[model samples]
Target: MNEEVENAFLPMTSVSSGKGSLVIHDVYCYTNQIVNICFINIPNNKWVLIDAGMPKSAEKIIQGAEKQFGKGSWPEAIILTHGHFDHIGSVEALAELWNIPVYAHQLEFPYLTGEQDYPPGDPSVDGGLVSEMSPLFPNHSIDITEKLNPLPADGTVPLLSDWKWIHTPGHTPGHISLFREKDQTLIAGDAFVTVDQESLYKVMTQKKEINGPPAYFTMDWDEAKVSVQTLRDLQPELAITGHGVPMSGNELTRELNKLAENFDTLARPDSKT
Candidate 1:
């Protein structure tokens, strides 16, 4: 049996919402409302979905997958960056529908199995209405133990041959990012975003800028800073974050290195601000 988080369709949206872009022939990034979910495939062969989208987005994801990989093609598995509500919104549905396994970090098992809740969002963080409204966002965890599997102990992402899962905790204890050394491609799941997720205006416009995790729910600024630095050192030629658009080339190099170098000033909020 599978269970879902209790959440309705959020009113949030972004200019990039509903758009899908191919970071490469194999990696496709799709924005549902405000968050980005990746559809990675070997085209006409096997594929895996990175994260489920916002609540009420199951159909959208199904349709997108069929369009990308063809009708009746289900992913080998669903790989979660973390068990955040938004990221796992459609997990139960998709997992049930496809009869596939869902994998996440073992440290996230408590939340995914409904044994605990994430710390509530902090609305006092700087930026905009998104941050100010954070408290209202759901922090409850849903039970999905039937389909949940911990990522392998060796850091390899199941079914994704060329990719390795890097523990990028901060936003959540089990947050992860995917890196493919062969092409220097990174799929950063909110370890750092390409948009100021705290700013409502910026989120809506989908402005591209390197910023830290969403300030509202991130539990550890210090850990997030280190995760960003870990990713920057990889020198990824292309990166698709969970928010904003895909960033690549010299812009990615310059922006990612800059954000990692100055995370304290650019990302961490003060004691009260």
Candidate 2:
């Protein structure tokens, strides 16, 4: 690992099984809110990055990849569950460096291609400081039209055969999650997060809680609940979310189930339409 980049985010954490068949690396980005950029390493030194964290995180992401697969190796493709600013922060830079395509859901085309702007984050919707400060989050679009490829309508993500991408919008118009049927490993983007992102203290400490996306950025509470329930039904054995450490076993399953069962109680916005 690049000591400099790894140390940039102190108390950096990662989880891997000794079986060694599949590995997930967490590249933590400490920014407006802490974000977790997960990279999955498969056999033959090949890998796929789930999301780009904050701006200027490309180097750290590359560093983490190299630590596992040797230097100068690039993923076959960069898959984005959404085009939210934090998630796509270093996408353009990384794609330029690797000369590889960036894949996103078809519904996300507007944001990725600079065709439309996402609704402004609703700071008034919640009381937390992060929610109250949401007005500062970027709502503008990123110009990466040339580098983006539409995900397959069949839901299979390219280069990752064992996994399927599920549409889980609400945090953004086109948010998504990845699931491996064989092992039930899920890479849930912001459809739901594993942290109480609105609290600076929880974020800094990497506290684990299964919650919805940052309240400020989440537009529709009802849809968000449905999205979470859809994911819970998959009964994933392991999950790596966008904002918390990877979770697994009965604990992860129980939390997901609770989130699904009481999504409205836990994640719905107070200001209902």
Candidate 3:
């Protein structure tokens, strides 16, 4: 298949989240700015890519993987937490180049398969420049129909037996987070994040604060709150979210609980679109 990627957005250099992985590697991206992606290492040099970073980032994703697992290594599969532009930006390019399948929650299929586009980001939500700039961000869906696959009904994840995918929507209908029962490590995606994503400074500094998902792109406030509470119930010892540095231990626990309990004040928008 012949594929062409049109990158009209600004491009910034990639940065590592510097969180130091136990089971995951953080490959950060800039769309003109920054976001996070996870490359999870499984046994035998095989791994999985979770949430493609910013638009036009396939090269950075591949390079980050090779740096971790050595040359010529590709993931067994690419699993998306959601179909938002930042999360699935380079999906088509990476999936096609690697000749691998991309898996996402069944509800996310429409967005991934060229069937639907996400609602526009709500720039009215709180934040500064980032939130204000969001209305200009892409909400259009990309078609990767041929390589897209629905996540397993049984909840088991491919290539990583120790981990299971948990349905944690709200940020998007089909959003999911990966959990490892053994260590209680959670890849929370955008269900929640470690930074106040609405703030451009915090994002670039990789600040470590437990906050709700990115406000501009998140449409369902109630579902997002529920998702945060559900994840808090997991009591993740370590959390690697879609943005910011990895947070862990009592700090992670304490902040996550606070966010879940006071989601309205901390996460909910003053006024939504």
Candidate 4:
């Protein structure tokens, strides 16, 4: 009953966006300066919303879903990759709006149920504006107890027949990535990203490059490295990440492999140990 919602909304500028197929479409929220929210199309008119976007984005997400699926449409459930503020900023609002169940890994429950806060972002890790502003980003946990549910222990995602949730930690204790084995399509949360999150200019431009999680928020570099390798081992042909554009084929393979091999040099921050 006591859910914390952000009062101030980040100013945004609209930008271009696209989809992989009818099965998956993402709306770029906060104009393209923030995170992406995905809508996974189920067999019937039903669909699933993956990771709510920034503060005050529930309307944008709802409108985008209506435009893609149809007017007066609502998803069956909401699946979260993690409880990062950006990912779940509007979750409490949207969950109440639609009165749907929200699922997340059990390890993430503390953050979602208002029991704990995430570790502070390390501004000393990098010198860019985003890094400089890291200290201001919300690190408090939200209380969405009534609507929250733990993911199935067997790793099967409800409502999504073909996709499975893979435990991919490091960025957060309970981070998970969604994968469709048939097409090897991966919905990589912050387990790994396709952009240099340390740079504001690249994030604003929405660059396409394989990299590790956002440096400032990642608490376990070793786990992050292992998590990247775990995903690389999956050999996902196509990957839609928490940031940047989607990538696939041999190019994605090549860059991902390189990132996995040279993670310390390319993705790890200077102060993390």
Cα lDDT, all candidates: 0.87, 0.73, 0.78, 0.82
Our tally of clashes for model 3 stands at 1
TM-score of each: 0.95, 0.87, 0.90, 0.92
Backbone clash pairs for candidate 4 read none
Kindly report which residue stretches of model 3 are placed more than 4 angstroms away from their true locations once superposed. Answer: 1-5, 8-33
Order the numbered candidates by TM-score, best leading: 1, 4, 3, 2
The stretch of ten residues in a row with the least summed lDDT in candidate 3 is 24-33
Q: Estimate, for each residue in 23-112, the C-alpha lDDT of model 3 and write its tens digit.
A: 434332222236667777677757788888767667777767766778898988999999887788788888989999999999998887
How far out, in Å, is residue 123 in model 3?
1.0
- Give the clashing pairs for model 1: none
Candidate 3 TM-score over all chains jointly: 0.90
**Which 10 residues in a row give candidate 2 its minimum summed lDDT?**
12-21
User: Could you tell me how far off, in angstroms, the CA of residue 175 lies in candidate 3 after the best superposition?
Assistant: 0.4
Q: What TM-score, to 2 decimals, does candidate 4 have?
A: 0.92
By descending lDDT, how would the candidates be arranged?
A: 1, 4, 3, 2
Q: Compare candidates 3 and 4 on TM-score and give the better one.
A: 4
> Higher-TM-score candidate among 1 and 2?
1
